[model samples]
Target chain A: MDKWYVGVDIGGTTIKLGFVTEAGEIVTKWEIPTDTNNGGRNITIHIGQAIKSKCSELNESYDRLQAIGVGAPGFIEMKTGFIYQAVNIGWKDFALKDELEKETGLQVTVDNDANIAALGEMWKGAGDGAADLLCVTLGTGVGGGLVTNGQILHGVNGMAGEIGHLTSIPEGGAPCNCGKTGCLETIASATGIARLAKEAIDKNPQTTLANKAEVTSKEVFEAAAEGDEVALEVVDEVCFHLGLALANIANTVNPAKIVIGGGVSKAGDHLLNPLAREFNRFALGRVASGAEFKIASLGNDAGIIGGAWLAKQG
Target chain B: MDKWYVGVDIGGTTIKLGFVTEAGEIVTKWEIPTDTNNGGRNITIHIGQAIKSKCSELNESYDRLQAIGVGAPGFIEMKTGFIYQAVNIGWKDFALKDELEKETGLQVTVDNDANIAALGEMWKGAGDGAADLLCVTLGTGVGGGLVTNGQILHGVNGMAGEIGHLTSIPEGGAPCNCGKTGCLETIASATGIARLAKEAIDKNPQTTLANKAEVTSKEVFEAAAEGDEVALEVVDEVCFHLGLALANIANTVNPAKIVIGGGVSKAGDHLLNPLAREFNRFALGRVASGAEFKIASLGNDAGIIGGAWLAKQG
Candidate 1:
């Protein structure tokens, strides 16, 4: 390789790996299904093989290779190369970097998946040219990352961007999977949207939604598009909570812009317009003018692109 | 002629001046009464005279002095150096830096009081060596500063660190001077403490505090220490709100440490222990573990020292 690096985005269902160049561009990328029941070490070996298979296809005697960068979920101890309890992977104190290195013999640098994805989004996506950026992933759960002064900030033990767990309502409300009530994720993520829809269905059984088998947020959105009252109610609540939570996040970060991505954000202006109105109402009037709320553009490609950008920095 | 900087800390009642060196130490400092009603130009002349008078006493040449750094209570419009709105001084768009330069023949840099104080504390006080720090000034009006990777964050329009205005309650709990209702400042600041004490006195007029002509937080703390039930109850409410506010802040910044200063911090363990306990209940598990709360070590001197430190950085 004249000059090349690798970027890995590990999620619950699939692990996306990319071969990238030095200018924050993705040359090639591939995805592999993740089977965590095979154990963490086996997963690392598979990821290494995926990287090697892609690098070999470049078809040149490599002069040198830059470092490989990884975006991981859960608490990644940057110094120890350990994953301290990744919930989706069912891993605790997992020797992630060591296992990957043992299989591929390449030095690895890992960070919280959201942090690197934010870097990717900032360098190439909606946050481009912004110095202060906050990127939030509205997936099965809410993931957050903060970038200030052109650098990712991780508190000691890599727990800096835990905005999902921020208390949205201190009193009794929806139960979060994190074993906490009143968490922001309990009210705004894809899972949270599904929960809100399910609750509405249970509370109002006469709605057309009850006639359908197996409720999904997508179906709810589709119903709302067709003018179903219950679905519209569910979406309005989601936007309301999301708006308040965004306002709170704005208060704290005062970032130039906030980028929202993942499955739920696909609701588009139906979700965004109300959220903008609410965030403005709650955000301090002085700094409220600075923050721009936008739906994240990269979608599924954010991981590879973010990885490529981070790898360039590496 | 060695490196010399004049550090000015302007408050409602006094303007503190210091000669600071490049090593972040205040060699000598003095305080003079400030006349806010006399206009910005008069204040500028008073500061210059204070600096010149100090130089004459030490037989130090005024020509050796570098630029001045001012920590004022308000919004600063960058190098133009106008006071956008110093509520304490009733100033709005006053050209403070230009006035001072013309009067004293020296260049100047100006910033909000809380931001400058945080810089001072970070340079030499409780937050020394902290890569991520959030300082909350617990005064008549609560204010804050955010430093990530050793840089002060000033959001668009220089209003980034308005933590005091973050809504703790959704609406209509108590009114704030900023025209907001149920803000964190309404329940957790020194003015808040006085209000809480006043409420207690109204409820339990038979208590010893009722005899006092003018009640203050200091008197309430004294009464509580003397085993007054109403005083203790009011204090407990303050602690609870303070904890919830800090927990919310912890979720946002995820700082390595939170330095509590200004007058109310003097309550020490009497307030800190309860606040920490309540904060634990509200903060996310991972983030709460990453940060420690501590009383600001620089105490009353944080403002002066912080201004001095900013001068050195300049």
Candidate 2:
């Protein structure tokens, strides 16, 4: 019988699930709405039933499922698989692995969603064949994941890849959601870019961005691509901070590859070309050219793919 | 007959060698001048001859030497043991390992001096049982070594633990030897402390430091200990920057312990007390209490001891 692995990515709004093969190919994938009410008490039941239904729909036996891996947003105890906190899902101090295992009668593994994504990239995406990779996701907030020696770097408190919280500007950096000032996330996230564009437009109403009723990070990149002075300045400033942050991390971790993912990364070369240039300027001369930069290729499926990889490997 | 390992710590001014037993005890140790003339061409020859002579003096045959480990200041090629560069000793792209191996007729291992020191600490010093540790040597310039999972973190270009290069102040920061401005080394190193004291005295001529022809880091700490206002400010600033840098790294690497070494570390609690307070203030709530701070205990013998550890484990 062909063994199968299942990956579950539990997010605030939706839970994405994928049935994957040992070869890292996703056999099938789907999503279910997340019920965050009652502190996510019904989450395990939903996941268990969904897995059973999905297996039945594919005419596959439940015994064929070799393992289950979950990617959740928060700090997780690696040994116990207990979630210390998942702010988005209201899962505080919950035994997610044990709960899911009991509900489905299957062994389960759990990790941070960002970590699994980096693992996914290393397994079959941009980081293919590379064991040491740093993946930064620029969504509403910036989240970073590090894969060293083919394993996630879960620091003492499972906060190892919290690069978003690193003080980028130190002195006058914008406030972050994490109650800090001048964090990398305050400038590198998609929301952060929009905020910067809004600030710049407020200062000078002559820029093309001033015409937009709602300025977005994508529009800022689009205008910069067209050589708009203000937009270009904004992009340059963003790249400077992001590149500096990457260089600092490179000097510390010396990763072989830095993979950029998230909605903002859609800006492509307009983002990568300048980022690479600035990264070199900040990095030590010897390490400046050591790491290769690449846009993440797995898209939205990265979470599920990464979770499956964990299950397969575990 | 019990076998022994030879550890060699190669510095710009001196070469320290030790004959260590399997239990990590140094039976005997000695030092010799480092002949850097002709681009350090004769360093390996001297090391080999010294090792042979030392064995003869102890009435031990060459057959009793099981392995040899070398600790040099540079980016070492892990597999080949080729030194990419060691600016102080003027060695660039030198095969120190192969030459010494040929002369000694034994298997050899090589690593960065700071890394070897960290290994030594982990094996027998402050980081005695901790598998993950970040050891920083605050000498003229800051050098860091990371030991993760009982192994050195030699990044893609051997730049792992280059925490000294991390930007401490993003704007109007001091220029660094690494061709950057406002590095942690610019604020936390022995030279950086003296520079800070000098700048403070220059601004406020009434301070006692202003009368000194040479303002040393030790004097600044001593004055601070005595409640000298200007010196206290300098210490505060230094602690703030060093603490922030450590907190940032703590969030990223999350090592079990942070061991402080080098000449500047001699200040003891005068440095550690303020640094701990600031580190907690900047670190994420979860990671704030995760790491323990300790003074490096091996003193100058750390290098040779670390080299022996590599020889024993390699």
Candidate 3:
């Protein structure tokens, strides 16, 4: 259908709204500040206004809109259309989907933001046409989605692909938000990489990256590109951890392709090469050979595209 | 659809055959010797004579047979109907489908024995009706299978589920056939448990189980039940590794149910209780609250049932 669909990518501060077509082309998009206070009513109204404003701006009737898809950042109940738990949003059991659907008067589909983003990429990004896929999003937190046999594996509950919280280091690790230690999220996420950079800065004062003011993982990559040995070591170590996680998953499921998304995957071949090498060392034979991982192609559009696909599922 | 079908569980020695229904019910099962050396042609002859004799004994005609489903132990290509690398079977890229079909004049379906056994369980056993499932056979090796939305999750090459080779302890523990160290199979399989028992017996010569003439996993379980300290330690150790592996899989996939089968699972709740407790300790909070696990239900009938189902997938 040529009718437009609304996709909302909910984040801590800005909520990205996109009117995308079934062909995965974004027609128009905008962002609005998320207001969580006063029972999330204002946020619901904002969503409706944004949909109405976009349709009106294009001289199109609201009925011309096909559906609304919300990529809620954390735990979500697709059955009830509620945002169950989002630490960033501070909303528990928030009827975000139901309220949005009621106000917008459109079919609304809501799921974990990362799962939708992974689906987005699978639809038209790096992992297109792959029936078996595992998508890892290395953002503030490591969120993952596993698609098998053309459908997302949502486990018993909605929390099927919680690979970040997997206990990699059984005993010692950095404390995580989920009250766990030594999770993939604690080491491989952009936030985790920054934490590592911060630790290295404290330990090695002679390092070039250590001399930089307010160091970030991006700065670490840049410094590493310029031959900073410490930065290189940090990257290698981080990739080793990521590789172990991928190998563990590979041995179990043997997905056809692993789509790496989020800001960090933009590190490109630098990350991809090491990830492939280390995964080769760890993954079981045939499982490692069967699945080839690639950098997610959709980049920022993965959320919008995957959200549309999720709506199509409904 | 139950005119008659041959369900052969091809092992290293015995070939167990049964007449199975489309509904997965096994009837008039019999066994015959597996002769892989007389050039694959002899296998069909043996299977034919055994089935004919069985049919004559039951006053049924050979013409009443419908199809044949073979469960061969090793890596198999279900789609191509070939056996790739079952070193024990002495078949490398053998066209089992064509050979069996040509000989028997009936359609044939073949797959890795463990995978078919899991399909059997998924179809009619403990995992019946579950949308997503992980089946682990804890025998000499920790063979596994993944079923998502009621279908097997075979990767590009049909080598989808190989969980045994997953390195549970990253650094070092025990050696694996795939040249890995500290794999889940090394610590938790039936062979692993027997090794642990032997090591304990060697170290603690005065212990109750140590004094036994021959130490098997069954003997170890028996000792543990009689409150032998050494037996208890070995059992606990095996279950500990199993718990880690299970939790790792659960955290990654979060399947609806996990079915434990093979020789080791016969220990039942003695092993399952400790395994579940340890899995809870290592699993993500959301997963610990969800994901049901139980012992496999079909027992020996799993092969015939799974084969019948795979044959139906034709």
Candidate 4:
């Protein structure tokens, strides 16, 4: 009989759930709109019911369902699966693993969403089985997950892999949501890119980006691809810092692969080429020689897959 | 009967050796001049003879010796103990562990000198049993070793802990021995400090250091202690880069303890206070909250002690 694991990814708007085979195949996946009307108190109950109904629809015995792995946003207690606070999901001091286990009658494991995404990449995506890997997502905010010796480094306070918060400018730079000035998040994130594009447009009204009422990171990359000098300059500045930060990270951990994911990464080689040039110029020669960069392939499914990995490990 | 392990720390000028118990206590320690005249070919033989002679003198049989651990300065193949190069000792392509085990009828383990020192600290010095650690040594050159999940992270190419080579200046910085520019070693190292002092003196010849025939890092620290304006500025600059690099590293690894070691570390609180200030300014809040910094307590004995730790683990 084939055993199955339930992988759940909890987000602000919706909950993504998948039944994954022991071999990392997604047997079936679906989504449910997040019911956040009551501080997300009914989340576990909804997930439990969803799993039972899905099993019945597939006409599979409950014995085939093994364990559950969840990826939730915000601060998490890895051992206890306690949610210190997930601002997006309106969860505070919630015992996610305990509640889920009680409702579903199975064991559960929980980890940060970003970490699980990295684990997913490591298991069945871009990580390619490299034990030491660094996965950075260039989304609204830059998120990072570091894997060393095939285990996620949660740090002492679960703050490890906070690569986006690295102080890149180091002096008199933009303020970050983390209350720090000049963090890499202020430069390399999608929001940061758009902000930089706005600043560039403000400085030079003759550029192609000046014509667009609202400049997005995608528009900036597209303009740069079309040889717009202003957009190219902005892209250069963004990649320079991104490359330097990634190189420094590679120097410290000497990862075998650096997987770049998220919306801004959709820039493809336009981002990676310049970023690699800067990374080569900044990283220790040997470290640069050892690391290979790849675009993340899993996309939205990374979280559920990584959750399955966590459940499989458990 | 208590078994004993032999720990060897091979340096350019001398080789420090020790007999340590499984509990990490050094029973006895000694040193010998390194025989680098013949490309370090006789090094293992000499160590083998030293162990045999010591056993005879102490009236202990060879059967009581358990294993040996060696700390060598070089690019090593960790699993095979093959030294690809050790420029200081003129050794290349040497099978250190195999030769040592053949000469002395015992098992052997080998690691980089900096890594062994970190292990020594983690075992009996200031690491306090914290599983994840980052140990940085500031000497003629900066050296680093990273521990993740209680195991040394020997990245894909054994360059994981090359923190000193992290590009700090990124542009128009001094060149390093590793053929890079603006590496952390070019600013925070003992040699770099003296060079910075010389540059400061050239610009402002009215400083107290202008009176000295030759200025050293020690003199710079002393002058700063005595309120020399130029010296204080240099200290601040060095601390700024050091703190920024450490903060960035902490953000990546989220180490529990950061152990600062080596000769330049002798500057003590004079160096730590300002470094801590910059560290707090740059590090992510939770990361800074989780990490505790400590001066390396083992001094020169860290290598041999770390070697003993390796042998004990083996």
Candidate topping TM-score:
4
What is the lDDT ranking, best to worst? 4, 2, 3, 1
What does candidate 3's lDDT look like per residue over A1-314, in tens digits?
Answer: 37777777887787888887877778888888988776555787887988899888988877777887778876777677777678777787789877887898888988777788778877888887787889998877888888877777777778778888877777778998889788889989999999999888788878898777787778888888888988988898889889988898888888888988787888888788878988988897778887888989877677777777777666
Interface RMSD of predicted model 1: 1.8
**Model 2: what is its DockQ?**
0.59
What DockQ does every candidate get? Answer: 0.50, 0.59, 0.64, 0.85
TM-score of each: 0.87, 0.91, 0.89, 0.97
lDDT of each: 0.77, 0.88, 0.82, 0.93
In CAPRI terms, model 3 is classed as: medium
Clashing pairs in 1: A1-A62, A120-A306, B120-B306
lDDT of 2 at A101: 93
Q: Which ten residues in a row have the lowest lDDT in candidate 3 chain B?
A: B38-47
The reply for model 2, stretches above 4 Å from the true place, is A1-3, A37-42, A60-64, A102-107, B1-5, B19-23, B35-66, B87-93, B102-106
TM-score of chain B of each: 0.88, 0.96, 0.91, 0.98
**Every model's Cα RMSD, please?**
3.6, 2.8, 3.2, 1.5
> On a 0 to 100 scale, what is the lDDT of residue B77 in model 2?
90
- What's model 2's lDDT at A6? 91
Off by over 4 Å in 1: A1-5, A21-23, A33-56, A79-108, A222-229, B1-6, B21-23, B33-53, B59-68, B77-109, B197-211
| TM-score of chain A by itself in each prediction | 0.87, 0.97, 0.91, 0.98
Window of ten residues with lowest summed lDDT in model 1 chain B: B305-314
